[model samples]
Each structure stands twice: as structure tokens, then as C-alpha cells.
Target: MQLTVPDFVGFVGVALVVGTYFLSQMGRMDVRKPLYPGLNGIGAILILYSLSNTFNAASFVIEVFWLVISAAGLIRALLLKSR
Candidate 1:
């Protein structure tokens, strides 16, 4: 599958955002304070949005998996906070 300009941009943007988070978590960069499960939820949304623009089935499936896992993490965080 050929990558359209929009698809490439979206894919790269999502990767950058996620990579930033990873770098921050690993102490490789000090971009911002950890947002805990906040970024997890937001990143999942961004991933799904990017997937919407991608033509690759593998990318779509990976994003769907991330979406589900992030949603679960968010829910768990919320429940723990409420308790």
C-alpha cells in the first residue's frame, strides 16, 4: 500500500508524540512532567485518528490494539483514583 502524504504525516506525528512520551519516561529527555494515564488516553485517541487516515491494514490493527489497551489503562487509573 502506497503512503499518501496525509497518511505519512499522520503516522509520523503519532510516532513523534509516542516517542516523546517514551523518551520522557526513560529519563532520556525532560519534556514535561509525567501525566500518568492521561497521555495514555490521549495518545490512544491520536493513534485512532491517525489510523483513520492510513491505508495500511497492519497500521490500523496496531492502532486498534493500542486503543483498547490504553482505554483499559485509563479505566484502571480512574477506578484506582476513585477508591
Candidate 2:
């Protein structure tokens, strides 16, 4: 198997997004805030993008479930903040 430019780009993008989330969670980065919603959105987008290159039914279902749960949490947080 060979790596393509798109694959490299996608991997880099995902790494950055996931790394940012972990950094924020660990309290390592203050300026670069990794909000839950933002992280979830990025994750969802990345997973969707990856589906095009290599599709997996099981993985797809799991990712979709994750996206839905994350979105719900984010929405709840926003609502709480607004109140």
C-alpha cells in the first residue's frame, strides 16, 4: 500500500484536531482553546472525509453515533450557558 497526498493531508488534519483536543483537556494550551463543540465538529468532518477514501460499515456507524452524542452534549452545554 502506498500513501497519497490526500491521505497525508487528511491524516495531518485529523492529528492536529485530535491533538488540540487532548492538549486542551490536559490544560497544556490556554490560548488555543479546544471547545467540545468545535472538537466534535472537526471530528465529525474528519470521519466523514475519511469515509470517501476507505469506507467501513461498522466504523461508519460508530462514528455517526459519536457525532450524534457529541452534538447533543455540545448543544446541552450551549443551552446551559445561555440560561
Candidate 3:
């Protein structure tokens, strides 16, 4: 088979999301850090972009939620930093 740009984007997105989780699990990264949710939000955006081409309803829905949650985490982190 052939690999397209969207495919590559999706793979990177998946990697970022999974890598972030793995780092958090191993305590290499802090969940409260902006970088954590920042990477997650970026990954979700890339995934959503890839989905625009293939169009999977389930994956799209889940990614949307993931993006939202990541955004909330980022905001919370910023708020805490301000305190």
C-alpha cells in the first residue's frame, strides 16, 4: 500500500498522545505541566485533521472529546501557575 500525508499526520498524532501517556505513567513528565496537555491538544488537532480525510465518526467524536479535555487541563495548569 501507499502512505499519504494524512496517514503520516495520524501516526504522529497517535505517537504524541501515546508517548505523553507513557511518559506520565513512568513519571518522566508531570501531568500538571503545560507541555503534557499541550502535546495532547496538538495530537488531537492533528488526529482531527487526519479524520477530515477518512471521516470516522467514532474516532472523530472521541478525538473531539480528547481535545476538549486537553484544553481544560491546560487551562487548569495555567490557573494553578497563577496562584
Candidate 4:
């Protein structure tokens, strides 16, 4: 099968999310840092945008939660950093 732009976006998003998890698992990433949530948020948004092109209910639902949670964490991290 040929790859579309949306599919490529989804793959990049998957890589970002999975890479973050790998770093976290290896103790190389700090969850408390803004970068963590920021990357995850970006990844989730990319995946969601891709989903908008393909329309997967289950993936869409989970990505929505992931995006929301990531946004919350990013906000918290930023607030902490400002202080």
C-alpha cells in the first residue's frame, strides 16, 4: 500500500509517543519536565489530525484523552517552571 501524508504524520506521531515512553522507561526522561508533555501533546495532536483524515473511533477516543492529559501536564509543568 502507498503512504499518504496523513499516514506519514501518524507514523511520526507514533514515533514521538513511543520514543518518549522508551526514554521514560530507560530513566532518561523526566516526566516533570515540560518537554515530556510537550512532545506527547504534539504527538497526540498529530495522530488526531491523521485520524481526522481516516476516522478511527477507538484511536480517536484514546488520542483525545492523551491530548487532554498531555495539555494538563504541560500546563502544570509550565506553571512550575515560571515559579
Which residue runs does candidate 1 get wrong by more than 4 Å? 1-20, 27-34
**Candidate 4, lDDT over the whole model:** 0.94
The TM-score of candidate 1 is 0.58
Residue 25 Cα positional deviation in candidate 4, in Å, after optimal superposition: 1.0
**C-alpha TM-score for every candidate:** 0.58, 0.65, 0.96, 0.96
Task: Report the error of model 1 at residue 4, Å.
Answer: 8.7
Instruction: Give the residue spans of candidate 2 off by over 4 A.
Output: 9-34
Candidate 3 achieves a global lDDT of: 0.94
Backbone atom clashes (below 3 Å) for every candidate: 0, 0, 0, 0
Look at candidate 4 and give me any clashing residue pairs. Answer: none
As for model 4, its CA RMSD to the true structure in angstroms is 0.7
Per-residue alpha-carbon lDDT of candidate 2 for residues 1-83, written as tens digits (9 for 90 to 100): 89765566557656755776687679875422226655765676676667768778886687677678767767777777777
> How would you encode candidate 3's per-residue C-alpha lDDT over 31-82 as one tens digit per residue?
9988999999999999998987789999999999999999999999988888
User: Who is ahead in TM-score, 2 or 3?
Assistant: 3
Per-residue lDDT of model 4, residues 3-81, tens digit only: 8899899999999999998999899999999999999999999999899779999999999999999999999999999
Please list the Cα RMSD from the true structure of every candidate, rounded to 1 decimal place.
4.7, 3.7, 0.7, 0.7
Which residue pairs does candidate 2 place in steric collision? Answer: none
After superposition, the stretches of candidate 4 with alpha carbons farther than 4 Å from their true spots are none
lDDT of each: 0.63, 0.66, 0.94, 0.94
lDDT of 3 at 66: 97
